[model samples]
Target: MRLVLTGTGASRGMALGRARLEHPSRYLVDERPLEESEVDAEAERLYRAIAIARDELQALREKLHGALAREVAEFIDAHSLMLADRELTSGLFELIRVGRYRASAALKMQRDRLVAVFEAMDDPYLRSRKEDIDHVIGRVQAGLARESSVEERKLAARVGEILVSDTVAPSELVPLAEHGVLGVVLSSGSQVSHSAILARSLHLPMIVAAHQALSHIQDDDLVLIDGERGEIVVHPAAQDLARFRAWQRELAQKGKRLALLRDADTRTLDGTPISLYANAESPADVAQARTLGAAGVGLYRTEFLFLQRKEIPSEDEQFLAYRDLVLGMGGLPVTIRTLDLGADKADASGLVMDDEENPALGVRGVRLTLRHPQILAVQLRAILRASGYGPVRILVPMVSTVEEMTSVRRLLKECARDLRSAGHEIAEHIELGAMIEVPAAAIALGGMIKSLDFVAIGTNDLIQYTLAVDRNNDHLANLYDPLHPAVLKLLAQTIATAQRAKRRVTLCGEMAGDRRYTALLLALGLTDFSMHPGLLLEVRETVNALHREPLRAQATALLRAPTRARIERVVENLKKAVG
Candidate 1:
């Protein structure tokens, strides 16, 4: 067997390790925000606008065929929904009238608009859903350009388990699952994009943001990719081959068992419940979550509705996305996080920061929103408008103090006032909450939880920033351990504080979905968890079959240990005991 590693595709004929998957797409955009020159020209605007609408129309056609089987009424209803989507339609108009963009320009404009909406979302699963919409919009922006001929696509059939590539796009990535392709390694791509999302989902033994992949080897050469290890070896001898082959076999076993983890509201043997939820970034992901039997979406990143467009999303545009998510949930409550952007999730105006040693700590998430407060007002209005349509929870991230939460509430109240002043009735009631990600905020959980309606632990950033470990960096990946005792203590403490205050708390982090931690977290008093839709059911099943009461006692006993290893052993024993 051979491998196709994605790097910069340089001429050097040799390159090092493969690119590992980065964070879920809910937190980052796939492409760098549209360049200045690309957005400045009117000709580009006109071209982009027409292209986007035309492509959306094409998508509409695909849906219409399916709807026709239902009824003309269903078809009309779908069209009406699309037509009434002010956020999307207005984005189309803005590209043509205000931005004067066409084709790529307009498509980029729509993407920018979606970025803003995603910024307003509170749910990570909701946020991850943006990748799907981005895929649709990107397809629209790109029009119907077939990168590979039918025969070229069939190249996937020729190789027993090799990856294929087309042009500079990560074209080889998409067909891997269907083509009986073993793994994906793209030749060239930005850090954030559809290619990255696909890689994470497939768990490809792949890499991106690398150089010299395409030129280094011919089609038939033997190569091995340690995707889990982020290493790719070209012309490896028998030893390397045996190792990778063994690993591939092991991974295949995991794949077969993964689907067995289905979504459910499960309880342990002692009767403790585990709230397993999906983390999606866009409205489109709601459907995926449902298929996985997800109880609800934990994080709905409402930013994509704003990015890649010429103008901001109107309430109508925002409403369509928000409403679709709420309705799509089949009565499941969708948690919406307001825009947590400034640096990474830039808009038509562009990124607000210069080169920095650490951009993640720089102007991003709640920090960005506080500076550009007016941006908050628009999103508040849109989210509020959508609230009337379904069960929606509003959450704010990176809140360091009571003051920020109070200020955010004031803005949300003002949005209600505006809606009332406009002679529109606001939604009856909405739940407001804060993310306990920062340590300072975690410490203040009692006060914040008392003041706020709920508290959700965003363990992703909490552990990374708390430990000063950039989870995105390959060099530091070993050090970025969620299982580290200090991190575990922090998580346990945060949950305890929330529980003591008698406030509802949930975890929407990478840890919440882990099977290894299920017993520990439940014992620690965390009943609600938000994770990727794919893992929702498995976590649920583990919780369902396990005994909760005994596990809880064991967890309490383990927390008293001084060493990390000792604590882990206790946790392992609890799972085994429950079994």
Candidate 2:
């Protein structure tokens, strides 16, 4: 029987394949108590399991190469770090050694405790990290059982099948793709989840949050999934198959055409040139950016250096990292965002107090750095030292007031003076910018503009803050729209203000990478966009196909439109007009 199902389209593509139903493989532990004599042996067994789990992740990392390796390594590295976290490992061992619990029972107890902490948090991203706990625990449990894991079995056998599951993990996506899994259909997941992001990067068709998939989809059932539309046809008819085949051909042709534009200039149909930059973190990201012909590095996150560590990164360590980044860009301008850690980002370095009532609203980003001026000083001095290598710009994150920007400028001056006294060469002039993510900062750009050389609108946080919506919450996903009228009004105001002040502004959020918003952003007088390296070419394609003048002409209507529905309609008309 033919049936239709709907879901949130997490990744854009189309897949027609036989459905492979995946039952959730949660490891259920028996609560058998360990005898005093069995405690030591059980502890040893736990240790062996952890070591094996670590080796499995290492083996998976070794199997990947090139872009896939870089893209997937971070997820693997994160899981490995979790396995090593003393808080987790120590608690598990304590349960066995002192509490007289079985190894499996101890694992379950520790997992539950950690998951409770993640779940109590108001921040959706942090809450979603509970999924990581589940994945890591499952891996260790599989090791303890000494059996082929469900993931391993599925990876080995599933070829040309669209996997239907309750949810998928970030680490599973790449390996499954490598194994020729056609696509994925999740009964529950958020589009903003790491798994969704990876699927999009890998160009794998995926429909997340399809609550009916598992109950409705049977193994070997012919399924056609349209990732862009979030529509799944179980046992699709002949017409559905025919339509999918045609769309596949069209997409292939589009891909071939896009490949040709890699070396071409980025300009609109009306001959207006635009800047497309990359938001990068590691050396691999920088290399990918260069390969994709990105104009520069717009947002190079520094938080990764501070994470998964026992102590804060030293100035020398930071200097080397930033210096290598500047040199890697080969003199193209690089914008380095100061440490934006706090909130959902784990502070393993103990630099932050974990007892804040609301970490997101509390000391984070610029606030966290300001509170620890010595940390700020070290980062500034390192950034100043690296400026000597090539063009570098300092972008302060989460700046809510002119005072924060002013204080950073004063400290930056001091750092430069000290670097010169210490006989270090530095850039003659380094640009300073503020990430306008706070609602207060966007509204106060007029006052803050004087202190900033440039500004980057971090729409990910801006939308969250402006709408009072937790973006990572799957339930509130509908409310966390980027195209909300108020968001557009705020975005338009920021862009116009920066343009009038002759300050370069860039949108370096997820919005910048999505092709659907390219025309709208262009209309808002935004000339610079920065996104993941993998997404730049597609956005460049969107940019090249647009007539900026017509889009710009609709700016007034877009902003003045009272409702989201109206704004969307106007945007659609603008696109049609340009077409």
The candidate that achieves the highest lDDT relative to the unseen native structure: 2
lDDT of 1 by residue, 1-579 (tens): 444443521111122232222111122223333444655454444445435544444343344321011122222222223333466656765654555454454556677768766546653323433443454454443332323222243343343444523222233343443444455444444323434433544444455444555556556555555444444566676777577677668657856665666534466666665666777765446677888777788888766665434576676777777778777897888799987654334344343453343456667667777777787777778778777767788989888889888888888888888898998755777778998888889877767766688888998789877877655333344566666777777888888887777777889976786666777887777888888665676577677777767766776667777777787778778776466
TM-scores for all predictions: 0.65, 0.91
Write model 2 residue lDDT over 80-193, tens digit each, in one string.
Answer: 878988988999999999998887888888889999998997776567678788888888988988867536855742888898887777778887998899899998877876
| Candidate 2 deviant stretches above 4 angstroms | 25-28, 31-37, 55-102, 105-126, 149-154, 355-357
lDDT value, residue 343 of candidate 2:
47
Clashes (candidate 1): 100
Worst 10 residues of 2 by lDDT: 65-74
Candidate 1: residue 442 Cα off by (Å): 1.2
